[model samples]
Target: MTIPPGPYSPNPAPLLARALRALRRDTGLPVAFGGPVSRDGRGFVIEQLDGARTTSLLRLRVQAGAGLGGRALALARPWVVDDYFAAEEITHVYDHAVAPEHLRSIAAAPVVVDGAPRAVLYVASRSSVDFGDRLLESVARVVQLVERDLAVEEEGRRRLAAAPPALHSAEVHELVAELSQIAATVQDEGIRRRLVDVCRRTRLLAGRVPSADRSPAPAVAAVRLSPREREVLAEVARGCTNDEVAEALGLLPNTVKSYLKSAMRKLGATNRVQAVNLARAAGALD
Candidate 1:
């Protein structure tokens, strides 16, 4: 029997690279490297290197439970050694690769999602040094960002796979609603903006069907909506009640109503349904 690869094989290299950069910025580490777990569940091949003295560490496959990185992958936590070669707790299989770089201190943190390690991030220093709480916390924050991004990307891929090529209006609305919920939970500004873009694309995808025979959408005066107002209306367009919209967007029902009213006033809509139709016509909701 053969074991399959880890779920996170071929990890998003760009995301890992960004996180590594963040690690270096926050902790001022001399070198940083990382990669996603391999497809065969064996280990990760180092695909990124930052500030390294040599390329010897690049593309090196660190097996699970063997070296500093591997042990972090196996345990789903961070491990740091002040003296890499002298660290007896970990195996020295990678000393041949590590020693050439003159690295004496190293740390590894696993990017875990839903209890499983998906990738590993490593930082090292040429001089022996102990990592303190502040540095470790910084590393943790960067890893958490990567974990959230990976989870978001994974969910997006799954939904895209399940969606029909031409989504029905109802399906699109559901997708928009789910994306909105996900966007609300995201703390990273960049990731949140990307999610918003995905929501816009989903709406555009639903609007792609041929409409040559249908009457032109009614003319609605151009109007700009505040982000909160637009968010509330987007949920309303999905047939969500004010309370439901509030819950989804993490707002009070009264606040939701205020935003809805403000948007309706701007769109000159007589009611909630009219506001949604007008906003859709004006290309604001999409």
Candidate 2:
């Protein structure tokens, strides 16, 4: 399947910036630095820091299970070297990059998303104080925060895609709330716009009428729907059969049937058609 284009896809610059800001706030560390590492079809590159210099610059290139950062990515855990030259656990993949910077004490943590390592967060210090558990904890907290924000955005997108076009004002309002929350937390302009787009679409769908002469339906009160349920209802309102909805939404036909049945029961409708009509009347279908 084609991956949807999103601000979170690549270009780890924003995450790095946020990570650095958090790192700097940790009073325990005299120095901190971070960059993103990726292994893709084009190979590996450390998306360099925007405006910072260090005596020792840690770099990891395309190779499996090599160097401190690469090993962290491979193993999906944080790794640290109190003394880089003396650390005998792994081979230095970027000796050329590390040597010029005079980096000695180093720590690396994988910025994991889902079950895979997407990138690494590395911090280095000149002195050999081991960088400690405090530094690692700080990094983990920052990563969790970032991941939470991403999860919000992802959930909002899923809801928007799943929701039927005939949603009631209440359902639309609920989605708007979710979108607004996601938009507020996201730092990326592109992601923010996408959230806004979802809100606009929800508004449009809710505002529509069965006929020009008929007054626009009253808005539905705010009501939350799970992302999957919203998607199923959205397809149903668009006049799609269960099989069609399932195919479009990447769900089994039985699952789509169950979602529609559940939605019908929740909206207190007798059948699929009534469910759509009542949801519209209740202002939930927008």
Candidate 3:
């Protein structure tokens, strides 16, 4: 599949500002800010101040796998440093970037998709304590939310491309509604563009098809699974059994089986294996 180009322009500044605000609200850390950084590309830069005096800090460039943030991006996981100067795994690639900011304690988490790091979220504190798992979890939650929005936008594009040429008027309307909803909920500029692209394509498709004035047919609603159902389906796609899903999700075997059944029904699949395949086709497992 062709990866959609990054949408970094339209709402990135506002999104960065919101991310900074969320970091502050979630962590209460002295310096709660993060932005997308690219080794070969520009990164998002955001900052929040807690004091009356606002100070301008030096700008720093980060390379992948170098500093704390780079390491997080490289590993596609979260990393923390209690004392930046004392960390043994420290890569000096971004040391220059942190020096001017007077960064000490730092934590970073990768915003990942398809097992690749697309961006990094970082939080730094002047205090001595390491940024704990609680803070990391908060950052991860935000990243996951962003990734989900991205995924939905991608799916919308694929669906539009594959839509039947003879789609009924009601089908066209439903597709437009889905496109609008996804666009509204998606935060990433890149994903939003993909959603719009799908909308545009669907409009083009609609124009090519003859319009009918009869009562509209019921549109098929795209299935939305709960987080647990999503997780279970993901695991099932990986060849996990009910017992394995139970262990992974910390649920009873019966509960895992139940989730699988419900997921299958929602996906309109006859069995677990079929559900996994259908889910993947629907881009739920992308």
Candidate 4:
């Protein structure tokens, strides 16, 4: 569950991909696709489709209160039509688009984040069978998972946007990627989202402010330092003594000294100050 980043890489909007793949798990539905609600809340644009019958759905616009997705967004809950052409629970604004795709039965649920609709997810079957509670629950689970991912990502963006100029050089992408990975596996949406927020803020401060070895330790040559060692060294580089480093890294004084010692040994340094100097010279910390 601790998917700490091995290296920094951008976490492209994962909501689209994670939502689509999660919906695709229900083999009963041969065609599935979904997208994020626009920030303006006027509509949503489809970004991912799996086994889609027609590309017409690509970037298709679903106006609020109009189609299945729109209706779900408007209601802020899951909405399904046993037959898209006959169902009275929602509007039929997308018939032209739906017909080309030959979609008979369809279901939709809003991807709610922090109590507002962020996106809409949809699944369809070509046959006449009605989508039941079991299938609906699957869609809900996917939406919840994606919501958690977005919440964490939003925190990362906010942190990066607010970061100091000098600290901006440290990568936010890797820290966000690490949070995204861990959030993806968490089953509880609330817990996952909260965890992601903490991860983003915590990593941002650690990366930007500098630490002993540096919690997000980067690799150089083959002389690797454990994450703890890197963090310990980063604090030392920041001029924090053992007690200060221990408090900052959430370790005891002796533990902080131990990690620093380990890092120093790995860096071929005889002391804490020498280890930090060597790490900086090797581009392991900045």
Q: All models: lDDT?
A: 0.78, 0.62, 0.61, 0.67
lDDT per residue, candidate 1, 1-286, as tens digits?
1113222222367677888889999999889998878655568888889888899988898888989999988887899999998999999999989988999989999888777667889988899776999889989999999998778766765675578776665567567667666666655556566667766777777568566533344466469888998899888755577898999999999999999999989988777766775687677876
Count of backbone collisions in candidate 4? 15
Stretches of candidate 2 exceeding 4 Å from the true structure: 1-12, 27-44, 54-60, 164-170, 181-286
Window of ten residues with lowest summed lDDT in model 4 = 1-10
Kindly list the per-residue Cα lDDT of model 4 for residues 1-286, writing each as its tens digit.
1112212112323545656766877536777787767666767877678888579888788888998888888888888888899888777778877888888888888877677667778888888875667887787777777777666556545555555554421344344444445544555444455545554454445455545434444343578778788888877655466898889978999898778877877888766655764565455665
Model 2 collision count: 21
> In angstroms, what RMSD does candidate 4 have relative to the true structure?
11.4
Question: Which 10-residue span in candidate 1 carries the lowest summed lDDT?
Answer: 1-10
For model 2, what is the error of residue 229's alpha carbon versus the real structure, in angstroms, after optimal superposition?
Answer: 34
True-structure RMSD for candidate 3: 11.1
Please write out the lDDT profile of model 3 over residues 1-286, one tens digit for every residue: 1122443222233444555556667776666555554434334232323321234432344556767776776666788898887789967655654666676887777655455444556667766864567877777777787557645654665567667758765577567656656565665655565565555566455556655643343222477877898899877654466887899889999999888888888888776655654564455764
Per-model TM-score, in order, reads 0.71, 0.58, 0.55, 0.59
Best model per lDDT: 1
lDDT of 2: 0.62
Q: Judge candidate 4 at residue 219 and give its lDDT.
A: 43
